[model samples]
Target: MRKPAFHRADERRFLDERGSSGPLAPNGLNPATIMEKAVRERIVDSYFYKEQCFGVNEADIVDRVVEHVDFIGGVTGTVQKPTPFLCLAFKLLQLAPGDDVVDEYLRHGGDRFKYLRALAVFYVRLTRPDRDVYARLEPFLEDRRKLRRKGKSGTSLTYMDEFVDDLLTKDRVCSTSLWKMRRRDILEDLEILEPRVSPLGTLEDLLEEEEEEEAMQNGDDANGQGHDGDSDSVRSVSRSRSETRPRSRSKSRSRSGSERERSNHDRMDVDEPGTQRSRGGRSP
Candidate 1:
């Protein structure tokens, strides 16, 4: 009988091609044991686990990720039932898909179906070696798409980047304890990993650049209006004042001088009474 490609021929084969399995039973102690016992138990007991997740192959898992998986979480409901998302995660661990299939899952992370990519990310964090995990997951830090995450703390909004970061740095995620990962700097120091380059670069530098651009733009706007518009208005105001002020001042001085001259002419016309009498006597 020909078996499917994802089904490993080695002893590591946990599920046959038909995906036959007993409830809560795993073939070995590697990945199935990686998840906590309580979480594994809840997942196996879940109705979604019994109904939807049963007999799912690697291809079927993708369909489930696209259709059924919405929120990333370990358990939901007040009674603490395992979520369908968690059930599929356990299913992947149980089936142990090959690296190529996992890569295919990651390749679809470009906004059409982000939840599926998240599923692949969680699986990679758990299964892959620490170095591979960092190398695989670090590239996706630039993915800032929003995601809905459900947990014991209730549902909340989270970003794709934030979720991947949690898987790397946080001790526990989705109600499962994550293995401690080496610090990124330490790995870079040992020459194990290249230094991480931030996608947005330094946030402070970006803000400063934006502020400078706005300032330059405002300066340009001021110049645009002031040079052609306000400058002429200001000059006209100054010119009108200069032309009218001295003319009024000169007119006032001339009127004052004429008044003084009129006073002197009246004084000359009205001779003194003694002078008039002397002239009359001399004529006699």
Candidate 2:
């Protein structure tokens, strides 16, 4: 018998593909490594093209980074170990104008001034820090009416802020109804970001309301009707006070998902950095 045509073709083809006459690892490349390389390339192209003046649009940059932001926010039980890409993304978003994300960021731990200033300096080349974008933001500064307050910390306007604020304002007005209402959904994924609106009352407000409730409770107790007092009445009083007291706007909670609605946002820093495990606290 003679060796037939195309005999051992599979073996030869495999060697040809590898550019070697030997076997190699079946998977060929590590996914994590590939992802890392890809992210690095994109960042260099997007943010570090020194010669390319005024490169990527700030709005576009923020949109691209939103995924990383969400990833950083969702990782619980750990002090989110963000990759360099994630860190860069965070830096970009911070520099990007738009209070939508910044407002949410303020809810997280730490002083907002430091983070905001750091990002502003990195992108805008400002000599000092400015807490409020509304003041020196390029587009807003041009429009005298929108210049609500002076720039904070003596920082000047940056192109990044101008781009972001414009994007946000435009999205609110010209974009579809969906985009206008989509901030809460986008913000939900971030761990540090919270509803900008506050659900709690001020110390004074709480005290006053509590006093009122106590008075009502005392009257009922004296009449021997404390136990028999209508549950609705008690709820009504508390709820009324809660409603009337000036509150920082709370983010709207979605009731459609029963499971999510029932879940609390609080975390005990379980397995987190900057925190020690303690027996006194309830389970995370």
Candidate 3:
């Protein structure tokens, strides 16, 4: 049978259950074009892609990903054996799992089956809209669960949060080229996304606490105590820097001027003795 130029032979809808269409590449790039052509070809030709990745529907694919995927990686070794994670990622591109399936994958393992979650987010990044990608992936920034990732160099430790972050910020991850995503701040400005709240809270608050502690160490007796008593002994020390910054600047400027004058006076005193000694020698 003559195969159509656009679709691959292996890629006819395996079962009526799955509607296999090319990735809904937001930019209209076909699914085959989503991955680099060479990499896509490699994945298609690889033993895993041929054997395991074939004929899987949305439901089966999920099982395959969770049960089979151990280490998250791209191609590893000199022969470039594709990781099961990458193979499944490519499988997702082919099956084109719907939003709900993707969500199921994201929420599926919770902490138990993390690589599945990793694969889901990877697929999401490849397929979803810019705003949705940021909104969905940013929450995982706090996941912090450890992930094992393998590569040409060998396996290394990574975290779920770090992987999610790389998906958002990096141009390439796990050897797959990521589509350019809009900046998070840009989306927030457009009101497409809300600003993400960090788990540790704003950095400014931590700096303020540290500054208060340092100031208290320098002079607790002067600042006095507050409601917390001992804990708030540094309370007065925590006054907004803006209020006292100008006064400190003025004091520093005056001190520098006085030091300069004292240096000049000392120089004059030393020169007077030298001048007297030279004058007596000339008179003799």
Most accurate candidate by TM-score: 1
Error of 1 at 261 (Å): 4.5
Return the candidate ranking by lDDT, descending. 1, 3, 2
| Candidate with more favorable, higher TM-score: 1 or 3 | 1
Q: Output the number of the lDDT-best candidate.
A: 1
Please give, for residues 63-172, the per-residue lDDT of candidate 3 as tens digits.
78767888898989998778889888887777777777778878855556788889988988998889878877888888888899999999999999999989998999
Over 182-269, each residue of candidate 1 has an lDDT whose tens digit, in order, gives: 7888889999998776876777889999999999999999889878787889999999999999999999999999999999999999
lDDT of each: 0.80, 0.34, 0.78
Which residue pairs does candidate 1 place in steric collision? Answer: none
Instruction: Evaluate residue 216 in candidate 2 and report its C-alpha lDDT on the 0 to 100 scale.
Output: 96
Instruction: State which candidate, 1 or 2, has the greater lDDT.
Output: 1
Clashing pairs in 2: 73-191, 197-249, 198-248
TM-scores for all predictions:
0.70, 0.24, 0.68
What is the C-alpha lDDT profile of model 2 across 1-284, one tens digit per residue?
A: 99776423122232134334333211232112212333323333443222221233444444333332211111112332223223343234223444444333322211322233223322321111222222223222232211111121232333333433543445321111102223433544653234333245567788999999999998878777655567768888999888866442332233335546445333432345434445335455
Question: What residue runs in model 3 are displaced by over 4 Å at the alpha carbon?
Answer: 1-23, 219-284
lDDT, model 1: 0.80
